[model samples]
Target: MKNKFQAILLSYFLLLFSGSACDTPEPGPPDAGLYHNYAELTQELARLQAQFPELAKVVSLGKTVESRDIWAIKISDNVTANEDESEILFVGGHHAREWIAVDVPLLLARNLLENYASDARTKNYIDNGEIWIIPLLNPDGHQYSVTTNRLWRKNRRNNGDGTFGVDLNRNYGYQWGGPGSSGSTFSETYRGTAPFSELETQLIRDFAIEHQVAAMISYHNYSQLVLFPWGFTNAPAPDQTLLSQLATTMADSIFAVHRVRYTPEQSSDLYLASGDATDWLYGETRVPAFTIELRPRSSSPGFILPDRDIQPTFQENLPAALFLIQWSQQGGTMTLRLK
Candidate 1:
């Protein structure tokens, strides 16, 4: 498995990242596949663990405001122990409406496990590296999106008034209360009363730090961008060159799969979103963090990325992830210093 993984690293590395422009996507309605609801996601994680006990391990980081378990699916060779293997963390569903974001990581987890034996590359990564997939980070918000509101963006944290949530992305400790972050309870981008005030954000923060994740990608949708940090500010990150290169490589890999173009950018390029997960992960853990805003950049409706797009989205992002895993194993993954 390791030999094949290395073989892929040498052979497909160039094709995946530095390939020629792919043709435009075919015109059609993206398949509205069965997007998983909160309950379904929990069950799916459990099923993966049950089926692949050696490679898959399910554990709850903590519970959300609504008391839903924030599950972590750890896929690695030594599932029970945290060995020397370099870890790459993938988190999705920060916003409930970005249903495609949720499925991407879930699909990634499923593919890695189901193909462990049959696929040599998958087997190599699973057997040698630690891949942590947290498919639904904001479960309460996801549930809210499904039942009450289709566009809920925050966790179900009831503010003192009538408002019901704080944007988890905007509530991280780094750059808290800065521009692009909100203080009003009713605001969709609310930064919360204080940083890491919500259990969900705090849980992720603590877990990522404890595990010392080498690289982290927080998934979102409707932008078709691969964003690197300094999300809180316009200043370049210390590891700008490497970060930019990796992000562009991933963007190129995604483009090659679906012929969909995704600009590799700094978060502030689109807008100022302070206290976001990417920035916090980098500042707090020195993990080379990225936020991949998935598919249908201009034409598709913002958050309502169709169900059919889920498979292709994952297909495109997987190669970049594989590249990152291999790079981390070689100890060149995260170069930025912790703040």
Candidate 2:
């Protein structure tokens, strides 16, 4: 009888444990909405990793000026294969007001991985090379745009003397404080107290060195222009022929979709900019780099690019970005070849 009582007690304990376990719920799919915050973005990253363990992994390059995680997605067929092949780095949201910047990178990430198995073009690129995407580089600024001011343009780094934030694009080591770099901390074009002084800039610099990038695209807003290196001067970069060919191909492809004229030229020729990412990437590593300013010109409120424009801008820019990937992987010419 005592043995039977002990057996009943064990069965009751098992039932209680099973009931508690059943009460726990599973997580739902990641929300891909445009207004998703930083936490949601991180959750999306986790979901992508779980879904495509073979193709995606998160890399915490460093912390932002505001101590936010600066995350990057390294997508390829295999980690070993990535090291052997050339890398193409695509970044967006360098400027906070450019809300459209986030969609492109995130959508690109989604499209590339989602279509990796079926899309021959995506398959070929991943099979042969690495694609590094740093979407929303300025999390502090990006979040601020979503919550506070829609026109915020720099990392929220204390610049001292009562000034706050720094133009990360103009805080790189290349030609810092040179022409086009404003001295005033309050200015949008402020180069920062020193080169790479902002943690956000340092994250980019470190990532570039580690990846040995062959080509890069820094997406921006307002101006529908394809800008190359030499942001600090009018002189052309050494790989002018190759860079120009790529830019023309991209511009043509972009125009075919939207029919918008995007004049391709050196940055200095377009507008003066110093200590910028494209120049540093091109001038230092001789990698072909372009600053692609997207749709909704300056007349429009910068950060309020509508959701309706998202699909069209993404569809139009897809071909151009894919062209860059194709060029980087093949290393010969800029041509879109999709089987």
- TM-score: which candidate is best? 1
Angstrom error at residue 100, model 1: 0.8
- TM-score to true structure, per model: 0.88, 0.85
Candidate 2 per-residue C-alpha lDDT over 1-339 given as tens digits, one digit per residue, 9 for 90 to 100: 999999999999998787558643332343225645567777787788789999998878787767788888888998434468878899988998787787788778888999999988899898788898988899888777666666789888877688778898999998888998888998999888889888887888878777778789999886777888888988877777778778889999988987877778778886789999988877667778899888775666555677788888788888899999988888752332211
For candidate 2, the lDDT comes to 0.81
User: What lDDT is reached at residue 254 by model 2?
Assistant: 89
In model 2, what is the error at residue 134, expressed in angstroms?
A: 0.2
Q: Write the per-residue lDDT of candidate 1 for residues 1-339, one digit (tens) a residue.
A: 999999989888777755345453232332224888888888899999999999999999987768899898999987998788878899998887889888999998998999898999888888778999999999888887777667678888879798889988999999899999888899999999999998888888888877778898889988899999989889998888888998999899888987889899988898999999999988877778899989879745778777777788889988877777777767886554544
How many residue pairs clash in all the candidates, one count each?
Answer: 5, 0
User: Which stretches in model 2 have alpha-carbon errors above 4 Å?
Assistant: 1-36, 79-82, 333-339
